[model samples]
Target: MSFAISSNDVRIEERDGHTYLIASSRDEDGNYNHTELNLDECLGNNEGSFNWSGEGFTGSAENIHLSIEGPEQLPILRAHLRDSEGNTHDRDVNLSERIVNDNGCLVFQ
Candidate 1:
């Protein structure tokens, strides 16, 4: 499997003096997954796009995409990636409340 970051959906912003790029994924089972990659680590080179290809995910490889929105009091970044089956990924995470739920596909606190 190969992964490519779309330049059209990519975003970069600074908050609290730090930059972050929010990434997410969705699996064939309609499960949504998400992760945050610090700009300093992933975008240190300041490239306009990111692409990679290697060993396929051993277990389940979920479809992935990324979004960037911040530099304000409340950062709302939304990823529009889909899975192999074309299921949209959406998750709401509230750090302050320590609550997370992804359309009933995932739950965390």
Candidate 2:
């Protein structure tokens, strides 16, 4: 009974007119688990960092945490996820900067 979260699983989506930062992962039973966040208040115009720590619904996971931050001004990718085994894996760069552009802005073409 061991599960964990990854920083690479972070994604920005707009649902119900709300921009949420959804961190997705699988639990010990291979069940999909997601943690949502309101990026509107979490991050501002300038750039900020955040940490989220929690366990899966099955409780068979480590208290994994994902840190979100951006606007490095130089493509400073700093997203890393610590697995249940305590291994820190690096995520994509500039993944957090897209939130400002994708928050409430959509295109129809």
- Top candidate when judged by TM-score against the true structure: 2
Give lDDT tens digits, candidate 2, residues 1-109. Answer: 0111222255555555444556554444555555565643433221122222221211221222334443332222233444456554543333333332222221111
Pairs clashing within candidate 1: none
lDDT of 1: 0.30
The candidate 2 region of ten consecutive residues with least summed lDDT is: 53-62
Output the number of the lDDT-best candidate: 2
Full-model lDDT for every candidate: 0.30, 0.35
Q: What TM-score would every model get versus the actual structure?
A: 0.27, 0.29
TM-score, structure 1 vs. true: 0.27
